[model samples]
Target: MKLYIAEKPSLGRAIAAALPQPQKNQKTHIELANGDVVSWCIGHILAQADPEDYDAELKKWRMENLPIVPEQWQLKPITRTRAQLTVLRKLVKQADEIIHAGDPDREGQLLVDEVIDYFKLSKTKKNNIKRLLISDLNLPAVKRALSSLKANSDFMPLSISALARSRADWLYGINLTRAYTLQGQKTGYHSVLSVGRVQTPLLGLVVRREQEIAAFVSKPYYQVQAHIALTSAEKVAFTAKWQPSENCLPYCDEEGRVLVKALAENVVQRIANQPALVSHIDSTEKQQAAPLPFNLSQLQISAAKQFSMNAKLVLDVCQALYEKHKLITYPRSDCRYLPKEQLKQAKGIINTLANSSLPCNKPAQGADTSLVSKAWNDKQITAHHAIIPTEKSPENSSLNTFEKNIYLLIVRQYLLQFYPAYIYQQTKVHLLIAGGQFLSQAKMEKQLGWQVLFPKSKKAKTVNNSNQKQHESEQEKTLPPLTKGQTLHCQQGELIAKQTSPPQSFTDASLLAAMTGISRYVSDPAIKKVLKETDGLGTDATRAGIIDLLFKRDFLQRQGKAITATEVGVALINALPEMATLPDMTAQWEATLTAISEKKANYLSFMQPLTAIVTEMVQGASQQSFSGLPQVAFKPKRRKKTFTKKVARKTG
Candidate 1:
């Protein structure tokens, strides 16, 4: 019988439902009418060989042996997952043909590959064998994939890359954790000290910010403002604000009030004589495109900002949408655009969710146009397009508040493609008053277009808006009629006091943003152009997890959504060479991997260097002395978080 191995049980069940085979029975196994027996993995049934797996003596953690690199790696059942392994063993023993079905991304590839390694399936499968790569489990996609299944050999390099990364992480995660934990034990703190390549680097960013905050010395600065009446207003209105041309003034300190008044009177004499003139009128309109589809990083950022949703929660909900509801495409996609072929499904996708979609604040632009965006490239779209709804009505009521928000964000963008681009007019006018210049700025929308998709954010920015002061919409900054040479009456107004503000601290939302777009950060012209053309080191699926891992390990701490580094994180970053923490290291690694992916470079050649470097990291980490470990003492926020995700319902 043909044995079909699916990534998970739910997927296996779906595959069986689509096949002609009836029940081929085993514990948690099902058979279809076509005699294809299908079984699934609960994520992973096998894992990388740990040092403990080598022998009983190796199980004990000791520094005497230093780096424990196994000459030949062993495979074993995941202890917590052996229940599923038993079922897999029964099927693997009897099947004539084995179909390798797993998730399409790197992680998915790794998981399925591990199971096959555990059973040594590749060496035995010399007959009719195939592996299906699929992004989603919809019937059409599954059928299409089955008809085109390639031999397991087709993905050997990808499998090699996956295994290499896992082994590397094992060497890194196990060695570093043990070494660091032992050091903490030596120092009298029994806390489990964990360190990782990405985790430590991420923590360093937070700790650095925290240190900056702790070391900050507040400096007070002075500024001036004035109140003035414009045109024919009977009463003086609005705060006419400007700094003196001299840029300095004297202030009374305690008993110096009289001394200050004497200086102020002289300065007031000079201020009263000068005329304020409108020097220039300048206004321009810009179309702020709706953000790209929700990449994992983008989703994390939006969830944190819009619903105060945690990164982990967003991933969980998305997994549900993909696995349980089967209502959306892949959950952990890095790309925000669909492959060109999927563009044809646009009409069906729009119709399926016609009822579930909400009105966008601004109408979407460009969906109907034949003109396509670079985001929609076919070759770049490896497994799937950006996360989108399946071609069926989403069971809207079944969705929770936050899921609803995310799904709507997807729909809004998809629909937006059909709309026109945002159009607006900008106007700037400057006038002259007395001897000084006054300016005005305004924006008027010619058409809302796709701007409607990302509605005016409901999250309000708190400001002191009193009726006594005109409450101007942030969108509307109106200016009075004025010309470049326009003149205004010179009127003396009160000088107002303001202080210079410190640079804002990084928020989780902002930190993710700061991490993207390497081209913006690179100073060298050549480097910037190169980065602009390539995908950065970490994929969308991995970056947030890397950041979250840092927080979980106490390398980073969150105070309300703001991330800060702990002392340990800061020290670790400083301890490592500067290149270790820079994203370029990851970029460099990815560049080589891409070369392997394209057959331009051999996988072993690319990995051989990493193995040597990792060997040093593994062997050397245990002996390296650390001065101290950082402890995080943070108070959690008390306010209840607001959320906007709604559970997506399954359509019958």
Candidate 2:
């Protein structure tokens, strides 16, 4: 009998629907007409055994058993899914052929492959196993994936990489958590000090930001603005900001903000009613293409910003849209570009959207399907393409408020690829007044184009210009026609006093953005490059969970829209080593894992150093004193018991 093993039940049903009909649906397996059976796992049916599973002595948390490295790692069936495993075991033994169907990502590959390994199949049987990779649950997409099956052995490296990551995390997390929890107990803080490869570094980000905010001291700065009136027929007026010359260096701060009130006042007095010459004028027309389609991280950040939704909540909504509603493709995709071959589906998808009652229906109808944006590059495709709407219409999907909002967001982003670029003109005017340099800038929208799709309330006021100085103010205005050497009258100079503001606390949007772009936080160029190449500290599939873990562990707390580290969190970060708290180590591990997946690096080379690092960390932690940490009351968890009722009246 031919057997098909899927990653989950929903996927199993999807695979069965694409196969030959006349199938009998049983509780555990589906039997096809041709003696073929399809079975599935519930996420991971097997997990790495805990430290205590290796030895009884390690059951109790103690510093003496600090580094628990297992010589032969063991896998135990998760209690909740043992029944599913039993059914799979029976099917595996009866099958003559097997097909491994899993999600096309690393974790998905390992989840199914590990189950196959647990069955202890013969070498020939293992070699004969076929792999099915499915990203979209739509029938056409599933059928296409079914026709392109490859040998499961070809992905052994990917499985191996995942295995290494799992084991490494276990070793690092279990050892450090035990060690730190023990040390924290010495300070009367009895709560478990959980440390993870990603979560700890993420918590560190919040703690450090809190520290900076606490230590910040505001300082006053002064600026000089000249209210200038054009001497032309139009009689247009605009505000020009003072640009300090080399002579004003002594009175200016590092950011060119004048520190001395007297200096600013003198400039204001001198420039008052002065004749200003328009020495130079720069006018340039710029076109901005629509942003690429939603990657998971980008989508999460957008949802967090626009709707105040948490990262986990956004991911859940995307999953519902993809799996339940069949309205979107993969939700956990890291790639923001679509495959060129998929471009043919644009017209169908756009038509479906236009016919639907979505808020973006008008934009979809107006979209030029022939105009392909830069988002359709095959070379940039990763494990999965960008998250995009499928050809399926959402008219009868019965989506909730969150689901509909996120679906519309994804559809709008995809439709933007077929819209024209937003065109605008930027004008910069350099002026001279009383031997001082003044600057004025304005931006005029030449064409709304794709920008018209966004509501006026949601539109950004200004575009980011990296070259623009901090003191420069950009306004939306239409400057009167003027040439070089033209004179304008400075009606008056105003002195604006401002205080330097501390960095804003991280909101859900900014926090996710930080995780996605963690390279910007590092100082070392090598580490920065690695982080950028690896796409930051954690994968899109795992980042939300890591952030959620921190909150559950009391390492992070939410203050309205901002996320801050708790007292325990700050103390834990202070107690941990710098390497554990920073993202550099995680970036390096990610690089090594990527190399392992590419077959350029081996498991031993990565694990040996990791084990050594864990050993050193354990040894170092054993000697450290955590007495300075705040005391936390240990709350023991209460386990609920279930009672079975018996018929007492049976004897009567």
Please give the CA lDDT of all the candidate structures: 0.59, 0.84
Instruction: Give model 2 RMSD, 1 decimal.
Output: 5.9
So what's the TM-score on candidate 2?
0.94
Best by the lDDT measure: 2
TM-score of 1: 0.76
Using all chains and alpha carbons, the TM-scores for the candidates as numbered come to: 0.76, 0.94
| Tens-digit per-residue lDDT, 189-293, candidate 1 | 345455554455445455555667677765443323333445333333333433333332245333222223344344334445245455676766655443456
lDDT of 2 by residue, 60-131 (tens): 777887788999988889788999999999999999989999877788888888888998999999899998
lDDT of 1 at 217: 65
Top TM-score: which candidate number? 2
In candidate 1, what residue range of length 10 has the lowest lDDT sum? Answer: 643-652
Candidate 2 contains a number of clashing pairs equal to 0
Off by over 4 Å in 1: 55-57, 86-97, 117-131, 144-157, 221-285, 356-375, 428-440, 457-474, 480-497, 500-508, 514-538, 547-558, 564-602, 611-652
Cα lDDT, model 2, residue 599: 94
